[model samples]
Target: MGHTLSSLYPVHRRAPVYRPKAFVVDDLATLHADIRSGGLATLVSVTGSGLVATHLPLLLRESDGPFGTLLGHISLANTQWKETDSGIEALAIFTGPETYVTPNWYAAKQETGRVVPTWNYAAIHAWGRPVFFQDADRLRDLVTQLTDKFEAGFPAPWRVADAPENYIESQLKAIVGFEMRITRIEGKRKFNQNRSAEDRQGVIRGLRELGAQGDTRKTEVADLMENIESEPPAGY
Candidate 1:
């Protein structure tokens, strides 16, 4: 399934004030891939008292539709699910590589003393209507899928069936399953896209040097920026 920029949430952040349109990623595939790669997301909701947030590993069912559904479970002991009102809009935020960018890294700072520190990062926001379920069968399937996904990279993957049937059932009862039908998605990649080529190169070099010294995140961000600078939009 494919999505258009029209399906994205309206921009109401400081991004429009400083980050140029070039940094706004309208590509749905990129957003989906980012969500998949960055499995953990922050699910936030508003309750009567105030707001709540939970961090969980979410599964994106791409086959579901253009804006795929998000699947995850919450501990029954954690009452967020109970507090969550069905049909209410919720936001799921998935983040990618992020690092502190020093103003000294920009060539413009040297040429015109007109640079400030900023953060370089990538992120996606997914808005959806949440639905909670307690069906044992559905919960079983969801747990199985989550287990399979997380364990796939292991040399010896563990299966849910490996556990005793009664034990698994008891464990399943401790959690509740949820599915959020995604309605709108927005992605932002702040990789100095608004800066000149020389400034970008300087930033990339500084990041790589910082990464080589010890900062792993800077290394990853540098690589992402390099790739974005080299590849065409369609290629990404």
Candidate 2:
């Protein structure tokens, strides 16, 4: 069968989430790693008006609560924070590496002719009530921490202090910080773990071979597939 243009592309990014029992990632350490490396996340809240979503980066505090806490800020002009319902739980989604997978990689495709294409990805979801604040001191502290964490990746890392104090103070007034103490957290890594070892190996090899040609994202997916042996949580 010939692949159509649509089939050549990946499964939709907005595909409804349906995690199989085998896909549930129930480990704190692994969940936290995905949260950290996922970098930017989408914060969604339901309010009197409707649903609002903000895309931003958040700081994870593993020691803050049973699950954890998320720290981040938004522009003063962005009304999503103000419109969020405090009584309702907010959702923050962190997305890691993802790529389109083809059935051609499956050993079953050739042997049994019974395989379908799927997308492999890693993601983390955190839920909690968001508490927004505008205290200058607290905002300063939050921004400082966020700056340090992200800037550490650069050779010449910049710090909050590098900016003029007055400028920083003025800027702080133009934004508000929020804390969402995670009441629940879940991570999912769908990497064909349900497939037979032969099929899984073929997938890894196919992904890596694609990576060798230039698409490093495929390699990232392959790397996770290679480590599907990590112990799953209880009852799963």
- Per-residue CA lDDT of candidate 1, range 30-79, in tens? 88888888868899875544468989999999878678999999899877
Candidate 2 C-alpha lDDT tens digits along 1-236: 98533343322323334678778887898788778877789998876567789999999999999988999999999998878767667789999889888899889999999999888888888888889999999999999999999999999999999999999999999998999999878878887878888888988899999999999998888887766655444623
Badly placed stretches (over 4 Å) of model 2 are 1-17, 230-236
By TM-score, the best candidate is 2
RMSD of each: 6.6, 9.6
* lDDT for each candidate structure: 0.83, 0.84
TM-score between model 1 and native: 0.87
Give, for candidate 2, the lowest lDDT window spanning 10 residues.
Answer: 5-14
What RMSD does model 2 have?
Answer: 9.6
- Candidate 2 structure, TM-score to reference: 0.88
